[model samples]
Target: MEAGPRVLIVEDDARLAAMLRELLQSEGYEVSLAPDGQRGLHLGLTESFDVAVLDRGLPVIDGLDLLTKLRERGVLVPVLVLSALGNAADRVEGLDRGAEDYLAKPFDIDELLARLRVLRRRPASTVPVIRFAGGTLDAANRVVTRDDGGRLALSERETALLERLARRPNQVFSREDLLENVFADADDPGIVDTYVHHLRRKLGRELIETVRGIGYRMGAAP
Candidate 1:
């Protein structure tokens, strides 16, 4: 991969996912993992990934179904199917279903890396910074502000976290979810709650809506 491929791995096996994460990270690839196909598909659609490692068998949504949807929606990112089905027919079937490549279980590390390098050869992936609710977020700058010309400082972590939430208004993300997905570490569960509290105080009371007992969600500025 030229600039390093940002890969998304969709696997239900937690241990396998961890091993993949470690291995991919060691290879200098930016990695994101989803425990099920639903989250994986959602991330793939909303976020830009250079390559997606999709398990043929998934719980929430089948891997084939996700590849189909992505292809139907015109998302042409390379997908390398991962499965335990080693038969030649199975591999052929998966590739025919829109997979760029199919790798069976117990594959060698060198081969997996080789396949990822091949996936990255297709193209570079980038995400556009979204604007809504009368404010512009400098995604590259990791900053946000009101359109009224008022300036409020936000730390890098807070700004990045806020940007993720602000991307999809009315999307409720639990504290644990934010901790795991939004932040680099789930070190502080209370940190998300604290960030929400601080963000509300800064952006305005109604900028984010709290769904009692569940999590926090973003909304239009009042």
Candidate 2:
């Protein structure tokens, strides 16, 4: 990738979230920290973190619930569940929900970064770079640069949500699809609406059409 991979660390334990943030940043990643799942969900949906390190035990919502929600929403970003629930059954369930990898507590920072590297290294198919409603969305780069020449400021999550919907512009995607497309941590269903609102603000309300009873879709196919 041409730019640094972005990551979000959602851990209720304040101490740990700080450590992980520093560790990942030192390794050249743009890292965001959320102390609990509630706020984490906000950050996850609004920003595009390449991968997420989620703690299973969280206040507001548990880790498993977060993971399931992410998959249900259609956030295609890879997830690596970071939890102390290392039992065979628990680990199995995490992977089944949507985790690309699982790391138990008391893990080595180096090991976690190594796994993150693997997740980041995986390739995504190249689709024609999409242009619509005045902005150029680089599907492969997962970055959107508006025509105004403003800095490309999309967080990893914002980029994911836009790319998913814009790529299939005319097709509608329900809240579930957006969840899986952006929030890889299984946070909450309501969070889907929040992300859409944020995405709409950035892309311009006219570009993404809202289907009252269904979900949302881009104005027209690119």
- In model 2, how many backbone clashes occur? 18
Q: Candidate 2: deviation at residue 41, Å? A: 1.5
**Tens digit of lDDT per residue, candidate 1, span 1-222?**
366668999999999999999999999889999998778867876788888899988997788887876654345689999999879999999999999899999899999999989887876433355575757665545556678877667765566567767777768988776765555334668888888778778778777788888888877774
Model 1 CA lDDT for position 155: 66
- Worst lDDT run of 10 residues, candidate 1, spans 123-132
Instruction: Write model 2 residue lDDT over 66-121, tens digit each, in one string.
Output: 76655433445778899889999989999988788999888988899899999988
How many clashes show up per model? 0, 18
Which candidate gets the maximum TM-score versus the true structure?
2
Relative to the true structure, candidate 1 reaches a TM of 0.55
lDDT per model, in order?
0.78, 0.75
Considering only N, C-alpha and C atoms within 3 Å, which residue pairs clash in candidate 1?
none
lDDT value for model 1: 0.78
